[model samples]
Target: MPVESLPLFPLHAVLLPGAALGLRVFEPRYLDLVRECGRAGHGFGVCLIIDGEEVGAVASAAAFGTEAVIEDFNTGDDGLLTLQVRGRRRFHVHKVRVRDNGLQVADVSWCEADPVEPLQPEHGLLATLLHEVIDKVGGEHSKAPESHFDDAAWVGWRLAEMLPLENAQRQVLLQTGDPHQRLQQVLALLPE
Candidate 1:
């Protein structure tokens, strides 16, 4: 396992690998985090908040998290920073240190990359469901390449995000190490 210290952005949300997250930055601590990441050419860690809120105080967060890299940034009409970020990889936090400015810096071990597994015949329904979701929701996912629909990991992540699963459920999916196993988990979560 590769270990490194990263700026942690603990939120009430879960960011899965390959998922895109849009964020509005106004908090000073997170603003500092964005700036630091921009300067260092690395992204910050996003974990589900286990306790406390998004703003003020360093909240207790889940041990497993995803590394988010900035994809785009600009100032919104309201003057706050708007950012587009994409989840890169999963990690597990070993230790956390709070800065004087209240940003939580975590020493995390990066997990192995998810393998590219083709969608199995049993999970074809899941890929079909994801396609239906894209047709209805029609956002970034609508633009995803056709290859994504055939990928077990991509199909599972999209389904996990599109479904009405709780944050904890999303975290569980993120922590699932195998791509094919993730599809199995998603299958069990669907309405029968």
Candidate 2:
């Protein structure tokens, strides 16, 4: 896999592959990130902040993250930059450095993407639960492709994002490589 240097956006939230994230950009550094990404037609990485705040200083972030591709953008009434982004792929941060402008840039290796695997019969519980969760949310996922509940990776990511799991737990699920294994991890976390 190729190692690429990517600008990191550390947030208090976790974004799994195929999940959606909304970010408000008021910091100049992140504003620069949006501009740079727009100009290059590139995406940035979103990692969970393990320490420090999202503003002023660079925060310590988890090594695993999802590449956030900008899907839409608009200026809020307050004049802040609002971004609608979707998680593309997962990456492992090998090393990180602080730029002069305080942006935390990481040299990351892209993880192999999940192969298409239909949901297993044993994992059908996850698919049904996922359907209930999305219905309760009133279908706010138009931006996400029509839910492919039969797809193992799709089912796992949708649940990972909707489940009331802690950021650390969510990060662990994101790092799981095999789609079926990831579904098993999610099942283990469910209440009996």
For all candidates, the clash counts are: 0, 0
Query: What 10-residue stretch in candidate 1 is worst by lDDT?
Result: 152-161
Once fitted onto the true fold, the runs of candidate 2 whose alpha carbons sit more than 4 angstroms away are 140-147
Point out where model 1 deviates above 4 Å: none
Per-residue lDDT of 97 in model 2: 92
Top model number, TM-score: 1
lDDT assessment of candidate 2:
0.90
- Overall local distance difference test of candidate 1: 0.92
For residue 57, give model 2's deviation from the true position in Å: 1.1
TM-score of every model? 0.95, 0.94
For model 2, which pairs clash? Answer: none
